[model samples]
Target: MHTTQTFRHVSYLWDEAKALELAGNEVDLFIYRSNLLGADLRLTNYAGGNTSVKITETDPLTGQPVEVMWVKGSGGDIGTLTKAGCANLYVDRLKALKNRYRGLEFEDEMVELFNHCLFDPKCAAPSIDTPLHGLLPYKHIDHLHPDALIAIAASKDGETIMKEIWGDQLAWIPWQRPGFDLGLQLEKAVTDNPNLRGIILGGHGLFTWGSTSYESYINTLEVIEQASEYLNANYGKKRAVFGGQKLENTDAETRKARAAELIPTLRGLASSYRRMLGHFTDDARVLEFVNSNDLDKLAPLGTSCPDHFLRTKIRPLVLEPADTLILKSAEELKTYLVEQFEAYRADYAAYYERCKHDNSPAMRDPNPVVILWPQVGMFTFSKDKQTARVASEFYINAINVMKGAEAVSEYVGLPEQEAFDIEYWLLEEAKLQRMPKPKSLSGRIAFVTGGTGGIGKAICEVLLQNGACVVAADRDRLDDVQTELRRQYGKDSTITAAIDVTSTDVIAESLKQSALQFGGVDIVVNCAGLSISKPLADHTEKDWDILQDVLVKGQFLVTQKAVEILRKQKLDGDIVNIASKNALFAGPNNVGYGTAKAAQLHMSRLLAAELGPEKIRVNTVNPDAVLRGSKIWESGWAEGRAKAYGIAMEDLPAHYAKRTLLNEEILPEDIAKAVLVFVDGSLGKSTGNVLNVDGGVAVAFVR
Candidate 1:
């Protein structure tokens, strides 16, 4: 028997002093309040909630006091909402839109009018839910998607239960796609009730407000706390969840390993147009739901909350029952996935056709955004790590809501027609259109060896600039590289790990890191190497062995390990090996280094031929005399090569440049660009090739 769990209250984080500090201005207090409310994932998922404060500001043109409203803007998260992120609009102009509103059918037009109401023309764009805050009569208002309140709102007996908990303290409204009509409905409810503190939108979320920011903030917390009390009192004691657990969870490590093995394939299929990054989570709550007998039934019902649906899609595709999943072979799982993908796409298209309006933007991506494997975990894929992570969190929110709702009354998703209406809404289409275009390598993940070294670091930088999630794997100096990349690109775009390419075990760990951090790897760059130049008679046994180990063997092992992830994706992948111009030029006193480079060059060609059927292209960038930002040069290669030429150490760069047909200095950035060419989708048909970034070394050129 499951014991009743204690009611955990939403943290009351309100500090009176903090509010008082910002009380002089409504906008400041509103931003403050929004930050507090948005800080808790329990309060609202990323960008799911909106906050507004109707304030008095001086008109820039008229120099007179004007009533303005600031609401969290379209696609802005309240947790990080700044003044720049809030849409500032004239109140009179917003109310003026009411005259233009034809009916619920034409509510989308209201969004266009909101821009005209902007107090500043460059202010943030307003969302469709703007009127839900603007047209309201309160000075401060919040539209939040608290899981507890959404649980009640999504339940079969939601409104009835609300009446029981707060009686006349809160009002109820049936589910309505947020627009002018719903805002008016809200306005009327508050106008008529006169005694209600908040309103719960059926199968949607919650609405709370007060005369001041503090009051509104407190009201939101109080209402959620009250809902928690009621739900916890009834949840475990009332009935079994998701028809109760039907499968034992695989251990956490096993679940993660399975996800790592599986997501690459799913990710490739999902990336029909643009590749997606993945985030995996095995929150106990999610595992419970995944292990439950009702997973198949409930996951397909999708999420009731619009925000949840927007992140998680209308429904999740459950792969198999937890207990019997391991019994199936990997090939069986893969075959099943392909069939399901085709079926899901067709089904999504049908959904769009059934619900699309004549003016609806053409159907969006039909691939599933959320996938569930019984007893394994929930996996979400998006264009970047942060978005993927947020989606996963939102689905977990959906799970919590479902658990509480099923504990009392059956949990119900938004009606299919209603769900379609919200999904294909023109207002949302505009939001999607307004987003900045993706970079060249958006959603692609790359693992860079020696990522802290000069050439490796340059490659990582270029890849990150092009929007690839980079795992900068190096045996040393990872902390500095990770901090620099995080500072430059934010936490979502890059991660660094300490790894040795020579060890298969270490290489496997790097790929696992990539899988967990940003889905799977699509691009692999072999740049970890050292150079040893000496007369054949002077080269020691240790010198030859070390060069081969680090240069030839390391590159081989790195590519060998990453090929597993690439193969799993069942998609196109790129491996660029950094050999050297010396591989072909036969420079004097370079036996140890030249031999390793020659071996690397041929190995790349062999891998290219072997992996061609899998769409894994192998290529090489042979950089000659790359002295600028080179660790090999810093150690001894520059002096050794200079000695071979009977020239000063400082004279080697100019000597190499003068020797090339183009007489150009080959920088690390130049070599980095070469690595990019092989994977940037430009040379799709070209592979088993060598690009000499030697500034035109005629002697090193391939025949």
Candidate 2:
């Protein structure tokens, strides 16, 4: 239930919107308000809702008044919307499409008409629902899928309830598949009720309009409040409690741990892509819903609206004997999940055949996007974490909405046929088909050591950009690394852990947790290292022990544990260890660093030989003097190098950059590139090899 305080904490920046309005940028003010509506997860999620504004401008070329509709671009999320996020279209052209769209049903011709209506050829594709806004007369229009309103909209007695509250403030439009026809129907309703402030689409969502963005936004908020207050007062008693206890006795740590154990198995089963990531939630409300007796009955009723079908599927998959899954071995759990996946596929195919019609598109990938298990709570999977996170939030709200609706009356969803239509709607399907293909390393997961350092961070960034989920592990500064990565990629694409490379127990646990959380690891970059440059005769025993612990022993522990998980997944994997150039060409006063790296290099060869039968490739990347962004070089280590070479400290960088035949300044990105070459199998046939990232250093060249 939404408390008053909770609703008060909206993300809307009212002051910013006012400033924009005062500056004569009313379109920007509307965009800002739309972003606020999108940012509030309680109001809408992902790209669920859209907003638009009608502006009058004098055409310079024609010297005539022109009205333009700036609507949200297709596939653009309102949460991150901007001026460019909207598609500009000539209003007259869009309104004229009605004549061309003479058919009763929307088809390729309607799609072509929408494309031709674009004012700018290079503008983003307009939303499928652009016609809905185009036909409306208001200057500002807002559309949202708020859970509170959805609960009321999806109920059988919803229309009666609305009449009892607000008699004719909102015009009622019965359900119709959204397209040219639906927009015309809405326009007729508006004509029929000229005084109406908003329109409620049965089993769909609400549309509010006004002369200003603020008025439209507030109108939507008031409706949500009415729905929320009604549910809390009349349907409060129906709230489900987890395990029949007021609260679960376990703490947060315990819940996540237990959930993590089941994640890998769930991911392996629910995976539709080659590699799918899991976003687990042990949230109190989520746990309560999953553990409640009503879950099986209420959950599969379908989403509150048709728009959600693309991400959450029609329903969430329920796993039984959840208690047994907790105690089962990885292999046993995996086998059971595989069986469940097959059964699910068969069931989905049957449903498709039963509900599909002539205009229906082909069956989409039949895989469960959300899965519910008792002891483990819920796990949502998508192509990436951002998608999964949104799905998780949506389902959580669905549970709340269903509970409220069930209390009001027997909760009923749209019929199976309606669901099939929306899920495979031509407009949505065409947009998806038009999207570019995934990157080369899409759906792959990688675990990198020393992720807070330069080389490690570079590896994480490049991998994320190329479409891999990264688990960045470090001894310290893990939180900082996590924040930076999330900012760069997204919250779901990168996860971080505090791992002491010297501690076997810590390394083992980190690897296991990462594999479970991120599906499984396919590439492991063993890059954690620290070098102590000193004369061999003067180096203390303690210095040598620390070097060996991190470079040689630490590399072995991480790879050994990660490899075990990868092999169990039965997928070919790669292990690329970061060695130093001194490993191949030991320079003066570099004994401790050189010896440890040499050991790491040889160990890679041995591991390659041992794991070759399993198709696990192991290799080494030996980088030299990558000082531009290296923490090791920044910590006065370059001064030591300068002393050893008998040169000025200020001249060290140039000396190293120009020392190589190529005279290029080696960087962390350069080392990361070499690492990927081996991991991506550009050298697919070769293993037990050392690739150098130095700028053609003749002395450091391998024989």
* Most lDDT-accurate candidate: 1
lDDT of 1 at 416: 92
| CA lDDT of every candidate | 0.87, 0.79
Q: Once model 1 is optimally superposed onto the true structure by TM-score, how far is the C-alpha of residue 546 displaced, in angstroms?
A: 1.9
| TM-score of model 1 (CA atoms) | 0.94
- TM-score of every candidate: 0.94, 0.91
lDDT of 1 by residue, 1-703 (tens): 2122233677666777776677688888899999989998888888997999998999999899999999998889999999999898999888888788899667777777888899989988888889888878889998999999999999999999999999999999999888889988998998998888999999889999999888898788889989988888886686677788888878888887878777788898888857788988888998899888778778888899999988888888777754575667888877878898999999999898888888888988898888888888888888888899989999999999998898878899989988988888777777788789988888889999988888999999999898888999888888898999989988888889878777889889888989877789999999999888899999999999999999989998998889988988877889999999988889899999999999999999999999998888999999988888788988988888889999999898899899999999889899899988888888888789999898897778799
**Model 1: lDDT to the true structure:** 0.87
Clashing pairs in 2: none
After superposition, the stretches of candidate 1 with alpha carbons farther than 4 Å from their true spots are: 1-8, 14-23, 646-664
- Candidate number achieving the greatest TM-score relative to the actual structure: 1
